[model samples]
Target chain A: MNATLVFARKEALEIVRTWRIWVLPAIILFFAITAPVLARFTPEIVGAVAGDQLGGISLPPGTYLDAYGQWIKNLSQITLFALIIIYGGIISTETSSGTAILVLTKPMSRGAFVAVKAIIHSVFLAVLTVIGTLATWGLTAAVFGHAPADPVWSSALIWLLLGVFYIALMTFFSVLIPSAVGAAGAGMGAFVLLTIGALWKPLSDHSPAGLAGQAAALAAGKPVPDLLWPVLVSLATAAVLVAAASLLFRQKEL
Target chain B: MSAAIRAAGLTKSYGRKLVLDSLDLDVEEGSIFGFLGPNGAGKTTTLRLTTGLARPTKGSIQVLGHDARAAGNAVRSAIGYLPDVPAFYEWMTAPEFLSFAGGLFGMSGSALHDRTSMLLDLAGLTDVQTKIGGYSRGMKQRLGIAQALINAPRLLLLDEPTSALDPMGRKGVLDMIASLRGRTTVFFSTHILSDVERVCDTVAILDRGRMVAQAPIDELKARYGKEKVVVEVTENADELAKEFGERPWATAIARGALGSIEITVTDLGAAQHDIPAIVAARDSGLARLEAGEIGLEEVFVELVGGGR
Candidate 1:
């Protein structure tokens, strides 16, 4: 087997055997099971809390659309935050802990090391996103009596691309910073910058910043103004980040 | 014999601080070469440079006749390296980690399985069946050596392999290295002089990022190591040591245990013949006088001027 394939297998096994299996998967599954439940019961719960003091206001009845919105919101915010934290130490920890020296001294290239990590984690995020989306869809039908698969699938795919972008982004930071905590800080700062960048029209339309909004709009069955540019630019930027990380990691002293 | 590793003017620096300065070296094929140095003496830096894990700031290194930096996987595939502190995935057992290491070298199926099994037994972890995180420091060191050998590399670079091990653990690691004699060229770096003297055929002493001395173990002891005459007296041991320090043949003298004075000498014959006369002249009862064999520790201290 090639070094990349071998290392990728080790990384996959690591994800299953370590604490890594618990954190993000737990967060994704938790949101998948709870998002539709919360969307269905919120109206009745709010009405019960303010029974006599309705103040001439009436709460709207929950529906399947509300479940999709809740699912997209959680995926974009809570789940994305967890993903950033989980991948914070991806490359940096291996080097700092001296495991890279053991493997890199073999026939493996530094580029292979970085690429294997990016690919594995991106695949992991995609798998979790697919499973979570399916869970939300199934439970939404059980709770709201109707579930639209197209809206959920399209939105989840968009969010999955955004998640892949973050994986590459975090890999770049992990290579740039030697300390895991420091790398995570840089990743969060980039996230804040991306969120702020989304406020600008050009960045919103052409970069990863646009994916979150498009995902929410898609979940509500609304037509997006544009999607191709954002998707293309996001995937390209992700490739650039991973390539840059490999270059930087090669120069890094083990 | 052909050289397994050859370097010229090799240097490394972290910013303004130089870790290894212009080191030139060679290791004959199939020889266990000991890289001896004190802490912070750049032994690890030299090993890292040779392994291609860290690039040198200047000069070049050739491992198994290939440029370490430019040869990439070609050179790497032929070399195995164990860092001073080897780290493993805490979730992995010993066999799993060894198999992972072998896989990186393109070993598979029965070959990988047999290698992992042999390494696990060599590391004494075959039946332990515990995750790496649960292992002691000594167990981890043994496992580190095992993983490094997974590729059956032509050259094995070990940095301070026994620094953190206990007596039995140290003996175990030394036994493993000795068992590899003539099979692979072992570049072992350590501050433990005894370990080098025990298993290494040749040794190099490094101090403050420079090569001080490099030679065969016995040759180094004979060339730089000073012979000592241990003299014991019934009284006035300190005064006798002071007197011995003034003699023409004595280069250095120190008070030894049991009221004895050890005199380092340029000529063992002169010291043996003259020492008794001096003790009798001082009127102290001479109890014991014997010549002490020079060890690597004394040679290392002579070259580096201090113990680790």
Candidate 2:
């Protein structure tokens, strides 16, 4: 317990001292705030430039739903990339710089090191996700004067699970790959493969990648397509990956 | 007497290459035992095995009375290890790093705080408040020592602590090791003979994964050292060399240029009394004669064959 706390505190302080931690939150918050505003004004922007050329072409009315959809799209694509690029090197840097030797030499168990890093990252991701969601919510309500028609509870559940799955999966990848570039490459590659898999009609229900993509669908009042098995399989796979990392670390020479 | 560290028939190999081959070692409590070996002589491997960082392929190791294989945690808790290259989180300050290390040993709150402060002072890193990334090599090495001693371990393993430092830095680390002479049993591995001479009372010389010699410094010197007399003769060098070589007290004799001869003798007193008579009978005029004690470096070279 003490070891876990120590490692967590150290990791937390490391994130706080560096720029990577703030970069993700800043980028996510920027996207969250601007996403809704842009969605609300996109038609105006389109009309302003083309309005003088075309005699009259009135566009369809935009609502808070459109703004929320924009926000989700921004998060799923650009914001996830920002999160990956920022947090990808967390464990890889330690391993490459030989800092892991110092920590492992202590009385701390190998499992505790991986677990503490996972917990700290999970907390950071959760806090950032909440902040982004709240910012989008406030802007969408103010701009459109009404909340988007969706099951708020289900949307929150999906977003929270998606954030957790990404953090866990990234942590596992960071441990499996020795170099920062290798880790980031593996994570990004896996993400791309999963995203492509989700696009296939037959695999959408079983694809772990659907967790993040389905958030906007849940927010748009679409029924969830029974994703419990995928979530279960993903969480189980994350557990196994984390365990494999710990086992590899135990036998590692340095 | 309880041994602080003991390894019997310890063997370890990476793939087809054998690093430690059935080597045995016993370190007593409160003794600074120097582990001397050339590069890639398995010094780090032996230290890692004893500290529970790496397991041996064959044989047994007991540290602080715990079996290293079955009781790795217990063994680890009782020992502090410093790698050849000490690395720390660049994001952490000195105090933060020490506290984290203390917490790993189950210390917390005021107790951890007090120890961290004391260790920082002891390591001479009291004023450094910036992150470890800005620290000089010497500061990092000092902090390495501080962290290694955080738990007040029964045995401390240092793998070439001063190998990477400048002369001044090396002196500082050596001084710190010297200060802990009786507080903790230090088992440091290095090819630097002067360092061993500076602080170590017992030494074990390893060569090619085997123990060449292990004993008290004085005992090793006395056992393997050959006493010799240097004599410069005016004439009849060949006859003098033959006379000295044939003497009962002489172990070996080597003839030199300018009618000089170096004679190795088992009984110095007997040879001292009989040398003049032999030279007089051979009618060789002695110009100069000198006698001195043998040095450890010579004995080490003789035993280990001066490789590296």
Residue A251 Cα positional deviation in candidate 2, in Å, after optimal superposition: 3.5
Per DockQ, the best of the predicted structures is 1
Per-residue C-alpha lDDT of model 2 across residues A1-254, encoded as one tens digit per residue: 47778778878887788886778889878977886788788889888879677668787767777777776777777777766666577677776786887777677787778777877887887788778888888888888788753543356556666666666667777777777677777778877988888887556666467776677787676777786876786677667766776777666655
User: TM-score: which candidate is best?
Assistant: 1
Alpha-carbon error at B84 in model 1, in Å? 0.5
Give the per-residue lDDT digits (tens) of candidate 1, residues A127-243: 999999999999999998899899999999999999999999999999998888888888888888888999998999999988998899999989886799999999999999999
lDDT of 2 by residue, B1-308 (tens): 56888999999999999999999999988899999988888998998787666789999988888877655456667778888888998888999889888888888889888999998997778988889999988788888988998998888999888876789778877887888888889999999988888889899998888888999888988999878887887788877888788888888787657657888778888888887777788777778777766666767777888655
- lDDT per model, in order? 0.89, 0.79
- The interface root mean square deviation of candidate 1 comes to 0.9
RMSD, every candidate, angstroms: 2.0, 4.5
